[model samples]
Each structure stands twice: as C-alpha cells, then as structure tokens.
Target chain A: MNDQPAASGTPASGGVRIAVDAMGGDHGPAEIVPGALDHAGAHPEDQVLLIGLEAAIRAAAGTLPPNATIVPASQVIEMHEHPALALREKRDASILVASDLVRRGEADALITAGHTGAAMAAAILRIGRLPGVDRPALAVQMIRTGAPFVLLDIGANPDSTAENLAQYARMGAIFAERVLGIPEPRVALLSIGEEKGKGDLRIQRATELLDASGLRFVGNVEGKDVTGDLADVVVTDAVTGNVVLKFFEGLSTFIFDLFRDEFRRSLRGRLAYLLLRPGIARIRDVFDYEKAGGSPLLGVRGAVIITHGRAKRRMIAFGLGVAAETARTGVPALIEEALREDAARLDAAGAGAEGRAEETTLDPEDTP
Target chain B: MNDQPAASGTPASGGVRIAVDAMGGDHGPAEIVPGALDHAGAHPEDQVLLIGLEAAIRAAAGTLPPNATIVPASQVIEMHEHPALALREKRDASILVASDLVRRGEADALITAGHTGAAMAAAILRIGRLPGVDRPALAVQMIRTGAPFVLLDIGANPDSTAENLAQYARMGAIFAERVLGIPEPRVALLSIGEEKGKGDLRIQRATELLDASGLRFVGNVEGKDVTGDLADVVVTDAVTGNVVLKFFEGLSTFIFDLFRDEFRRSLRGRLAYLLLRPGIARIRDVFDYEKAGGSPLLGVRGAVIITHGRAKRRMIAFGLGVAAETARTGVPALIEEALREDAARLDAAGAGAEGRAEETTLDPEDTP
Candidate 1:
C-alpha cells in the first residue's frame, strides 16, 4: 500500500499524508469524501488519501480538492460489527487498508470514522506498539478542559491489573504533556468517591500502585469530574470509562431533545429558545465530541485518531488538526521513551511482573 | 419518650405517640417548628410530641397548636459534625431525644432532618430493627419512568452483599406495591448495561440473587430507564445510587441555572421564559425532593423517616405529609411481617449467620 514497497522505512522528503476510511461512518463516502477535501483544501501543503471503492468515493465527492484523492477498497467494518473478527477476516477492509498506508510509509498517519475498537485494532495489527509499552490507551483532548484528560483503554482493556492501571497513568500523563502541552499534568483515578476505601477492590489496589507511580496522582474522582476538568488526566479500566462516556453522550442527547421539543411548542417558546440560546449553546459546546475529535490509540509508534461512527465533515477536519498536532509534537516517541524508562525501573524494583508486554495476547488490532 | 410504649409484637397500636425533632435542618425551628405544628394541627386526635430546646421551640412556634407542646432539650446535631459520634455523645440532641422517646414510652415513631448517619444510628440503637430484617434500607420514592419508583437502600448500607441487595429488592417491591398502590410492582436491578454481565461485580451478583427472590423482577435497566417509568422498584447498592442521586441533583441544577441565567439576560429572554415557564416549572416540580419529602428507613420495627438536612418549610411540610401517609398506610406492620417471614426462611435455609441487624454495629446510648 506504500507509494514504493521497496521504500517502506524511507523518510519522506516533504509533505504529509493521512489515510481516512472513506466507506465507514453513518454518512459513509458522502461525508468522508467532503471532509477530507475540506481538510486538505484548508491545508494545501498536506495530502489525505481517501481509501474506499473508487466509484463510491467519486460519486460522493461533488467537487474535489486537488490534494484529496481516492484509493480503492471494497469492504467496511460497520459500527455494530464485531471489531476483532472483522479486522482479522477482512484485511482489505477500508479501515485496515487505510491503517496499512500509515504502517507501510505511504502516509504519515491514519484517521477513521469506523468502529473505534476496529480502528484501534487495525492500527495495532498494522503499525504495532512502541517497544516496552504494555498496552496502548485511547486518549482525547477535552476541549472543555482545554487540557487533555487521557482516558486510557476506554474500551480496550475493560479488565485490568494494578500494574496496567499504573502504566496507563504513566502513558496518559506523557500524552498530555507532550501532545496537549500541559506541564506535569495532574493524574486522577476515576472511582465512586474521593475516599481511599470508597471503590471496589480493583480501584483500591490500583490507587496504591498509581500513588507510587512517578507522576503526580490526584486519587479518585467521580463521573461528573470526567467532563468537569478537575484533573488533567483521568485513568480507569476500559469498562468504567465506556459506561461514563456513553452515559454522557446519551445524557447530552436527552437534554437537547427535551429542549428542542420545548422550543418548538409555540412562538413564545421559540423566543425563549432564541433568548436562552447562548447559554444553552455554551452547555452544548462544553459536551461536544466533534470538536474533541476521536480517541487516539496511544502507545502505538504512529498517530492514529479514531472518530465516531457518525463522523461528519467537521469531525473529520478536527481529526486532521489532532493528527497534525500529535505528529508535530512526537507524542508516540515520547510515550515509548517513557515506557522504556518505566519498564527499567519496574525490573530494578523487582515488581510483581516483568516482560509483561509479551503476555498480552490481545493486540490493539484484535479489538471487538 | 412516647405516652405509651409500642407492644413488642406484630401489630403496633395506633395510640402510640411519636416525638418530632423540632430543631433540625438548615431552615431549623421555622421548618421543623411549622411541620410539627402542622402535624398537630392536622391530626387533632393523634398523639405526637415535639422535642428541642424550650425557648427555641416555643419561639419557633409563633402560634402554638392546641394539642402540641414543646419538651425542652439543650443539644442540637449540626449537619457538618460527625454523625455516629455526635449521635452517641450528644444524649440530649433532638435526634437522640426523639429516638429515646420511642425507646421509652413517649413515642412510637421518630422523624428528623438531622444528619442521616446520626439519625440512622440513633434509630438502630433506640428502636432497633424488626425480627427478620437484617439490613435496614432507606426506601426513596423516586419519580422516574412517570411512576413512583421505590429506590431502596438508596443511602443506607453503603457497602452491601448480594443477599442484602436481594432483601432491599424485596422490601422495595413491597413498599411500591403495598404503599405506592402499584399492583405487582415490577422490580429492576439497576446496572450499566442490560446484558447480564455488563455491570460491577456487586450488581452482577445481585442480579442473580434477585432473580431467586419472590418479587416481580424486571431484569436490568440502564440510567436512562431510571427516568422512563419502566420499573416500580429499582434496587442498587447505596453508594452507586447516592452518586446517581447526587448526579441527577447537580444536572437538574445546572440545567435550571443555565436557563434562569439566560432568562435574566434581557427583555426578550424574560418574555421567552414566561412563555415556556409552565413547562419548565412542571419539570422542576416533578423533580423537587421537597415534594417527595423524606424517604422512610424501611425494615425497622417502626417508621423513622429521614428528611434532608437542607429541609426548608416545603420539605418539612412534605415530611409531615409522608408521616401522615405512612401512619395511615401501615408500612410499619408490613415491614414487621416481612422481617418475620425472612427470618423463618433464613433459618430453614440453614444460613446460620448472625442476623443482619446484629452485624450492623449500633451505638450505645452513651457511646457512638
């Protein structure tokens, strides 16, 4: 899939390319085609390869930007599809093909509007993890906080050990400082309460390990704090984070729907909607995920940003911005270096486990 | 103490008196004073007593009811003070005095707006639990799913076992069906997901145990379902439910604050607020805890309704209404029956563990 198969490791002379899965997302080729065009149009110096069936891509792109072009692929991993099985069986799926472009040096990065699990899986399977990293995490830049709060393994590792949580805190902290530009970002373990014995056995044990981690740890925070910007980086197992994330998304929709119904009731109601429009907009913007783009599969060697399955033009544009910022800042390399240092310390300390990465049979690419 | 002691038997007599903690809550004397006065004024034939400092209770009662009079006590339980310790040490505290009224022959019930922990501790020590009840649960009447959903153990038994949750489910179902007038109240186990394995360990275990319970079980329901009138009784560990309760309170405030702020911004906004005002008011009124009053700490031998620490006139008034309704509905006798049946079943099952009431260490009258 690289520009030259013989030049997989060769450095590019100039320009950067991002591969986007054009056939994925609710809007499919229509939204992805224009989003890529819109992004590449804004940045003439960069190129974005639209990977999908060429005909579908062309039919969707009403008017194309010169820097955006299509590369053909026939399959797509649907949002509800089993991610791990799809990633393995459908190697030529748009998401897999797109990730391979970055893996094989044809592109600088990969972005997708497919299933987050599938995209993360494809990236790990294709690009592979950085040396010494136990498990990669999914980190997001919370625009509300204006500082990244890395929610590692958001759906990646639902069941984790204390060592895994500690490693997540270490990687997440690095992501914030390197990519998000926060110095010594505060780390917090998400739990039911602030008390030491508040949560279940998992969090209780995890807290002790995280406290001893080299970074500053803020202890436990509740669900509201996930979006409240109280901590710079919030760490938790994937299961809890997934529930919180989805609950927030559903809650935002519920509130918005209630308002819309009330707003359309009468002229006066519409007037109130207009009057209170700004404040409501502020609330809306605070919870907006599009502006935040997708979760980046951290601990990988290259940048891979995964947007929602309903990604529109604006979300895609935000993805390009995130990818550019991440690549420019060298977040993955920094994370890799940090992980190596942590592993060395763990070995010296004679901790509970060593050579941990080899035991993790499930790769990021095997997500389901 | 009550005018006549309640017989330590299945059917408690209606002639038994109850003492009101007349100097509790944020709006103190005013709310408690008026609430007691209102109860005395409304129930002319019933036996009720008021306990607090004489001067304050008398002063609070600008207009005294014909049947009610103040029983002087100097102590008060501040909301910020440690509840368990305070309840034990401050013998004359209104909550302590009121609970002791039941222990003696002064009253059959005790109602308070003091710290919840302190009040619960006082009741457990003074009046004690019913024969078969192991864990006492506070059954909250939540307006979710357009019905009165009995949320049991809402802020009681913070750390619970599988059997404790099952018992709460049974009690909650009984409360809803028997008191709320819901026929065969559907009981749902609150969870993160509808799938069997999709919640914390406690919930997963509770789900299995609850199925074996004789109550009308309705599988699992997510956070959204809590508001959609799907279940009559929702059972969860108190800690998770408390967070959900707090979260809902915060969310409601955040929404209204935003709306009110916008409405006050300009003339146009004010006009809009006026137009949509009715709908918004209905929503707020539907959610107001004051209207719901105090949640009864079920599973005890007698009624001990725990009102909010922030109780104002409206909440205190609601508390009176709750007390009146509970007095008329015979929730206490039903609790006693349930406990007896539970004890027999436990003995038959050969689960020869200490009774739940014994496990929950209660403070002595002199030591918290």
Candidate 2:
C-alpha cells in the first residue's frame, strides 16, 4: 500500500527520509500523524513516511504536507502482546512496515513510539545488525544533569558478556563524539563502586577490558556518578541499565509529586509554588524524556529510534528529528567501522579471559 | 580494655547496652562521641559504651555522662583497607571491640559509621550469623517519596543465589513488620520488569521461590516502583541494590544542584527560590539518608547498624536509636525462627531448579 507520489520533494541533493510508525504508540495516529506532519513541514527537503492505516493517518493528519506520505499498514500490534509472536502473526504490522522501509532503502531511518520489545525485534529481525556486533544496544542520552551523557544497552541484551559491554563502550563513545559533539568522550562501565575490583563477576571483567581497550576509559562509575559530569558514555548490561533508567524516570515523577504535596499543604506553600512554578517547569523540562528525543537502537544497520509509548505529538516530532539527524550523520556506518578496527583487540581480550580470571577474586563486601 | 565503670547504672530494669565505634566514620570520635552522648542523655536508663583510642575519645568527649562509659580500643581501620586483612591485623580495632562486646552480651547492639566492609566483617567474624542464614544482607530504608520502603543486600553479597534472595525477602519482610511497623509487608524482587520472568536468571528463579514462601509476595517490582508505595520490602543481589541506592542518593544531590542553578539563572528565579526555600528544605529532609538512621545488617546474630562513613552527630544518634530499637525487637532471633520454619519449602525450591530451567527463555529485548 505505497499509494503515494513518493518523489515529490524538489531537493537538489542530500535529504533524509524517515519512516514513522503512525499506529504504534498509546495515542496512535492521533498524536503521531501531527508530529510527522510537523517534522515534514519543518524539513521540506526531507520526506516523512507515515506508516499505518490510511484512513486513520488522514483523519489524524487532516491535510499532510508535500514532503510527507501515508504508507498504509493494515494491522496494529498491542502493547502487551509477545513481540516475536505478534510480529509473526501480524505480518503487515506498522512497526514491521516501518522497519522494512528502512531495510529496503526506501527510508533513511525509522522512528517508533511503539511497544519497545516489538520495536527492538523488528529492528533486529527486519533491519538487521552491523557485522561483528553480537547485539544492538539501545543508547539513551540523559540531560538530567545539564551536561548530557549517553547510557547504553538500556533494555537490550539482558545477558550481555564482558565483550558486549566493551563493544557498547565503543559504540556509545562514537555516538557521544559524532552526534553529541563531545570530544574524546570519557567512557565508563556502570558498576556498584568506583574501584576496579568492584561489582559483579561480569562487571569486574568488563572493567579490565575497558581499561585495555584504549578508549577514554574512566574505569568504573557508580549509579551516583552517572548523573554527574564524570562520564560522557556509561555502559552496562541491559538489566542494570534498564533499572537505573527507570529509577531516574520514576524518581523524577515522584519528586514532582512530593513538590505538589508540599505546595498544597499550606497557604504559604501555595503562594511559594505560584512564584516557583516557572522554575519547576524548567526542572520538568530538564528531566522530561521527551526532550531527549527518544533512544537510538544502536548497532543496527539502519537508524531506528524508539520513544516512550506515552509520547505526545511534540515528543514524536522530536524523535523524528533525532532519527533524521542520526541518519544524516551516518552513525551506524561509523559504528561498523569502529567495531571493525577494534575487532582484533577485542578478540585477544576474549581469548585472555581465562588468564585474567585467575588475577581477580570475587570477594563479597560492603562498598560504603 | 573494659575500664572500671561498666555496670555503674544502679536500677535493675530493662535497658539496651549499645557499643559505639567512635573511630569508625570520617569524623571519628569528633562526630560520633557527641551523638552517642546525646543518645545516652536522651535515654538515661540505656548505656552507651564508647569504644575507640582512649585519648581521642576523651578529647572528643571532655566529660562523659553517667550512662556513657569509655571502652578503650587501640586501633582504627582506615576506609580503604581490605576488611579481612585489617581485621586480622587490627584485632583491637574499635569496630572489632564493638562487635566483641555485642557477642559477649556486654552490649545488646552495635553501631558504626566506619568502613562498611570492616563493620560487616567484624559482625560476621565476631558476632556470627543466625542459624540457616547463608549471608548477612544490609537493608536500607528509603523515605524519598514519604513512604518508607526497604531495599536489601545493598552491598553485602554481590553474587547472590536464588536462595539468598529468597532469604533476603524473608528477612526484609520481618524487619518491615517488626521495626518499620508495616504489617504483613509486601515483598517484591527488584527486577527489570514487573512480570514473573522479567529479570536475570537468579531473579526469575527468586520470583518463583518468593511466590511459594508464604509471604505477601507481590511478584516483581521494577526500580521505578521502588520509590513508590508498591512494595514494602524489595530484595535483590548487592550489585543492583548498591547501584540503585547510590543512584538515589547521588541523584537527590544532583537535583538540589539543579534547583540551585535554576535559582541563580535569573532575578525572578532568585526571588522565587527565597519564597520556596522552606519547601525545598522539606524535600531535602525527605531524601536525607541520615533521617532513616543506618542500614541494618540483617541475618546476623546481633543487631548491627551500619551508617555512612560521613555520619555526623545527629546521624550517629539516629543510628544508635535504630540499633536500640532493633535489639529491643529481637529481629535476628525472629529472622532465625522464620527461616527455620520455611527451610523445607526453600530446600524444595532449590532442588526444583533443573526442572524450572527449561520453563523460561532468556530473550534480549527492550522493556519499555
């Protein structure tokens, strides 16, 4: 259902084509369509392919801009469904169609505020991974501390090995350097303590690999240090990374709730809140995941952006913008080259694991 | 050296005898002595045995109160030293002396803001563990969101087995019920997701064990939900818990910094900050770890409260208060009884590991 005048853009040369899953997020096409339209309007040279049901897209979008096209997909995958099974059953699902567009070079990048598991599945199964990359990690840029930093494998590759973590450090570093414009990005392995011998078995091993890898390895940084300016890119297995990410997100919300309670407690607090409302708004803007423009599914062959399922129109628009910028910068290609250059060293490190295992002992102790 | 006035208090009534490690924290006796004295002053019936270098303790405390006594110790363990090595070398360390006092029933509880590793080592090597407890877990109560919730094994056992987590849940639940006063506390496995099979192998296995352990098992709670009112006791391996605990601590500091920056950004912001300063102060009070007292080292034979290395006067008093309360409730004995009763079921679950291994698949995917 590619019923579109696809080549309508009168660009002289370079332009990005982004595929957005219109029926993916909680608000579906109602939120996504307007966001896609806004992106298309802003970047007239770039094409925004809104992939979903044709009627819903048109209804939500009203009149689409010249650069935006409605590429129809008949099915929608619900949030709670098992990703793999749903992808297999719903062959024409919106996320699948969006990923296929990127895979086939019809779109330069794919953006979705969909079921995260489904998005990751589609990115891996349809768009594929870079050579020598064992897994495609999701990297999120955190602006919580004013100085933006990237944390990787947020919810991908739960059972990551030391090699995977080392690889994540490399990829995250490149993203920080090339996309975020941080020079010689200080890379750190997220662990329980700052000491080299701290953390779990895998973390201890990863620390050694990172130290030897020749990146700006900052040894180990704890969760407390992540929100500081200590490291530009932090790498960890998906479980710890996911938990930390969610905790930050949830705690910010909880903090705001606390403020609300405090403000409503008395008349003085209420007046104070009135005076402090703008400052609170700025704080909210800083912590808002939407302002970060979603996370990039790193190590994939194509640019795949995954925003929150609760994303609104503005968030969707920002996510699409990130997708366009990532595709324009050719981050995936750079990552492939970086990995290829470091392959021999990583191989030697893996082979030397047994020798290194004898060097460090796993002693359980309190870190405080 | 025990000195002379060990049993000076005349009244033959119920009163807790607490051994305080005066040379434990960053401030040493300078901070700890005042706090212990304050506790002794507040609770005149209870006795506080100040254990440290006699000269330093005397200098820190010019005059001891009637209920407080100086128990001399000749050594102090630096924070950076290895616990096992330090304990072997400094046999008469303040922490060691405190632990020995508790072991010999001279003191009903032990409190230290010293090297956490040393405190844990002293507690285990001197005071010993409760019967059937494989590892002693450190449980910290968080009051960031107004509701207090306990997260366990913060930095005790990094490589925890499924059985260890199950044991932590049992211990944490008992602490919540008896000490925190939460009735029939809801216990949850700290994981990446809320689903049954959402975490790493051990956490997934622990989920099953907790389900059948006869407690109010609430399945799994993610890091995001830990700050909320979802669960009273959240159990995990030390690595995750340590990172989360530090993250919460560090982020709270970073957030206040953010507020400071916002306040300094403009004239209006500075005025607004003045008006809202009291509310912000209340927020600080909520997130203050010192206000929660020290973390309890559960599963040990005696009441051992481990405070921060940076503990000051008020924090030390709060920690002693916690230690007194914990000893008064006989938490360790209660934990022993609970474990003895549930030993059969836990043993059965351990044996069923092989059969359950085939039931769940470890899939690497995003969990948004």
Candidate 3:
C-alpha cells in the first residue's frame, strides 16, 4: 500500500489515474470490469486501477486493457451494512483499498457504484476532509428545461447546522464554477417558498448567513425552482436534498414506464412510437442520469464519485470519466481555497456581528 | 347581505349549497361564473351562491342557471394583498363573504380559487377551527401510476411541530378514509429515508408520536414513495409538502412541454404525434391536476377548498363538486370527532408520560 510516495500538497499531473471499486456495486465485477475497460479504451491517457478480489476480476474482465490493472482486496462491504462500522472493521475492503490508492498518490481519484453511505465514509475516513471543512457533501448536477445546476448535501449529513448549509453553498458554488463552468454562480437556499421567512428556523438562519457571506445569494427557492433555472447552485441539509433527488429519480422513471406501456397498448400507438422513437430518445438523453455521470462527494481531500447503486456499464464508464475530469481540474484544491476564503470573511464579519453569529449557532436546547 | 334567513347547520336540505368567490381568482368572474353554471347545470338540485360585484358577475355569466344566483359583494381580495390585513380591512371581500355564508349555513361549504393565503385566513378567522384542533392542514389528493393518495399540510402551516404533524396524520388519515375511500388508511411520515433515525429531530419525534397515535402507522416513507402505493396518507410539515407538490407540478408540466416541442420538430415526429395523440392524452389524464379538484383545508369547522390560483372553469366546477361531496359525507364532522378522540387519548397519555410530552413539544430555543 505504501509502495509509492504520497503526493503531498500538490495535485496529480501528467495523466489521470482512477481507482475503481470493482466489487462495490450491485452487479460487482460483471458490470464494473466492462465499465473500467470502456473508460480505459475511451480515455487512452487515463489509467484505471480495478480494486477487488483477483479471481472475480479475472472472471469478469477476461482480458484487460494495457492502461487497466487489478489491485486485490479480500473483503467487500455489502450495500446494507452500516458504513462507518463496516469501513472500520474491514480495513482491506474494495472501497477502502480504492480510497487508499488515492491517499497514497497511486491514483488521482476514486470511483464507485457501491453503497453511497459506504463510499462517503471511505472517502472521508481514508482520504480525509479538506481543512476547515466540518463535513463533506454530495453535489448532484441536475438538468431541467435545458438548464443545468448543482444541488448539494444530497445525503452526507442528515442533521446539518446553519454553518454546514453556508459551507455547502460555497462548495456547491465552486463545483458549479469549475465543473459546470457557470461564472459567478448564483447560490440559493432550498426552502418551502421564495419568501425569506418561509421555511423553518434553520432555513431562515441559513438565509441570513448566505445573504451576508458576499456570495450571489438568490434568496429562498422552492422545490419547483430546482428545475426552473432559478439558481445555479441550491443548498440544503442532506435529508431534504436526498428526498428531493430520490423523488425526482422515481417520478422520472414512473413517467417513462407509463409512456412505454401506453405505446404498446394498440397498433396505432405502436406505429406512433416507432416514428417518435428518435425524438423520444433525445428527450430521454436530456434526462439521462448515466450521461450526467455521478454525484461528487465534495469537501474531501481526493475526488470521489458515488455513482447510483443501480448503475450499469454506461453509467459506471461515465462515472470514471467524471472522476478523471474532476482530478484534472483540481476541484478539491479549488474548494479548499474557497472555503478558507469564506471562513476568513466570516471571521472578520463575526468580530463585528458576534451577536448574529451566536444567534445562528446550533442550540443544545433545540434537541428533542 | 342577509336577504335570506340563515339556514342553521342542517347540511343544506334538498341539495348542497356552495358559496363561490367569483371575484377572487386570477380571471375573476369570467372563470368563476361559468364554473358555477357548470356545477349548477350538472346537479339541478344543488345551488350555487356566487359572491362578487353585481355588474361583473352579470357581465361574465350572461344568463345563469336556475339554481345559480348572484350574491353581490362590494369588494374583492387581490391575489397579492396581505391575507390577514386585507380580510380585516375589506370585511365585505368576496372570500370573507363566502366564508360567512358557510358559517351561517347559507351554504354548506366554501369554494375559492383566490389567493391561497387569503382563503386560509378567511376560513380560520370566519369559519373557525374544529374543537380540539390546534392547527388546520391543507390536504392534497395526488395520483401517480393510477394510484391516489392524500398528502396533508401542503401549505396551511409552514412551521409545524411534532404535535402538529401528529395531528396532521390523524386529519389526513380521516380524509383518506372518508373522501378517498381508503378504509384503514396507512399513514406515513415524510422523511429523507425509511430508516428509523433518519431525518432531523422534528421528523424523528413525529415518527414516535404517529406510531403511538393508534393509527395504522407505516413508519417513515421517503419522497420517492409519495408516487408509489406505499401509504394512503403522507403527512409532513407544510414547507416540505408544498415544495414536493410544486416540484411535482412543475416537473410534470416541463416534461409534457418537452414532448410537445419534440413532436413538432420534424415531419416524422409530427406523424408520430398524430398516432400517439390518444395515448398521450390518456397519460396526461393521469397527471391532470384539474381533475383532482381543490385541496381541502381540514380541521376547520366548515368544509373549505383552496383551489389553484390558475384554475379555470372546469377546475372550479370540479372544486364545487368536491365541496358538495365533502359536505354530503360530513367530512368536517368526522374530522372533528377524530380530533376529539385523539386529544382525549393524548390527554390520558400525557398524565403518565409528561416527560415524553415535554420532549415532543416545540422548543422555543429552536426558533432563530
């Protein structure tokens, strides 16, 4: 594990290296091997280190590309296992081993289609969090009405304070700027309504902090605004964000299934579906989660993408590409700088607004 | 205003009567008059009492049905006007007038497509709350995959406590049973995950309360489960519920618009559209908000419906139908009885479980 010297304080360069958890996803090596091969073929300059049991990797991959290699790990974390507990118990787990490669400068980034909680746990526990960052957040890039934006804290911290929300705004804004290429991203707090005092106390306090933080604060936005281009980056506690993301995924699938069933109901419908096939395909492409790659777990020292558990070869391949691209852009370093700058600004402001800061802090008496 | 003697709470004999706020919606009397006429025409025995300026009502309605009559009000509440302030100042506003009709039993129920805030204010201030009911909730009946479910506190109470959510569960369960015909409705708390300790403290506390409330509690259901057949009644604070509802509405509209634009792009696509017209129409019918009628503001002494501000004639007619059906079934009376029973149970439990009751109470320190 310590064969290569750790890359300290500098971003990986020359060519990108991605550590993929080949045994982590629902389909295991069967899906992960092909996905890794696909990525290696498409991105000739990038290398994929497939981490899993040697026998399973060989059984699935058969013949690997020149740029792809297998790194053996004896244990695997199941989807339903408690993330932190499992990570601590199985030190040589595929996800942990993949994260270790990133930590030791053997790989530039880590990619997995495994348990989301486990992926976040491994990334934070193995690779570590950026300095001054209290918690890492999962940033998802969503498209609505042909407009793309980022939403953060999708499932990392279930109970987040106003401070965590403010930090998410900063991290999400940076991700949108560096990855999504939105200049001076407009950050919005996801609340019940657009009014300032619409949501609960946590939201109200977060709104105030965001307004005073000098970001392009766009006031409060509702769930409808997530797909309305109302903001470039939307921030919320993990609970609400996770629910919204899942709901979007479920509803999208439900609608498509309904359409498919309708098209097969009659001969006339079948003919219509044939003619409309290409157009419908294009519409599906616009909403395709696979094409969007994976959601990046931000605030970690290394780039880690937590792909959907139901992801196939296409989604897995796209996830590896995303990992390579994120590493190339040095997004983690950029996020670290942004957070430091934000913290310094808050420190200066806090000197004069101590009362406001104390008012917004999490209260112990609030716990039930 | 009192030309006819007030028919005290005897459920509007012969046929149900609905007080319509003709001047309250975006389209004013133009939309409301025809909707009233439609309802009156459909149900000959039922009566429509249209409240608005006399001239405008006559101009828009032309000739009303035999059962439809204009009950003129001198003022109207604009959609943007402050709900409580305007209701106090404009005592004769159409919304207020309609509420008065329901309160005095001139009409069995109140129907309005006006400002939602205004409508809720008028209902609570004029019609009053049911006995043992602390907060009223707006319950929306949603359909997905041809399955219907009731969601409560959609916009009535934005900041809700555990006790309030517990009450919403009871109210929503009764609504599902009486109106939606779901006997022994399964109630679920809207949360980020299905895990017991998933969301914030408020949600966790609410889960405990619901479990002990003696209903068919189905534990916690995520946002993805809303459109699924996981539960009959999904209860949440108004903020989250409103966001989910609006997002569903916006996303549905956005997807259909995409399909429409896609079909019009080329000749082949257009041909496909023609053949798929009927199938697509059927799909649209499944997600049609207008067909669902208005969401009921439960926990009030009288039946009150808050229809969408953008509702048209057909939607208004359906809303009136909902009002008549609710009155006929005595939903308000049923809700009152359920609430009294729940209150009694809580009171008995509170004596021995004072610590638990105090822990569940809304903490003042939580308010920022």
lDDT of 1 at B54: 87
Model 2 chain B weakest 10-residue run by lDDT: B1-10
Model 3: residues with Cα > 4 Å off, grouped in runs: A1-10, A63-66, A104-106, A145-147, A195-197, A351-368, B1-14, B63-67, B195-197, B351-368
* Per-residue lDDT of model 1, residues B183-236, tens digit only: 988988776556554455556666666665566887877765666666888887
Scored by DockQ, the top model is 2
User: Whose TM-score is higher: candidate 2's or candidate 3's?
Assistant: 2
In CAPRI terms, model 1 is classed as incorrect
TM-score of chain B of each: 0.86, 0.91, 0.91
How far off is residue A287 in model 3, in Å? 2.0
Pairs that collide in candidate 3 are none
Model 3 lDDT at residue A172: 84
What number of clashing residue pairs does each candidate have, in the order they appear?
14, 1, 0
Residue pairs whose backbone atoms clash in candidate 2: B24-B114
| lDDT by residue (tens digit), candidate 1, A1-368 | 11223222222334567787888778888887777787788888778899988889999887667788788898888877666677767767998788778767687767888776677777766776677656677766643435446666565654467677787888788768766788999988776656554465556666776765678888877654555667888777654555445544544455566667778877867877877777677766655778766777776667778887788988888887677566656666677677778778767878764322221111112211
Pick by lDDT: 1 or 2, better one: 2
Off by over 4 Å in 2: A1-13, A264-267, A347-355, A358-368, B1-13, B263-274, B347-368
Q: lDDT per residue, candidate 2, A136-239, as tens digits?
A: 89999986556689998888776688889989999899888877888999998887779875887787778777787889998889878878889999998787
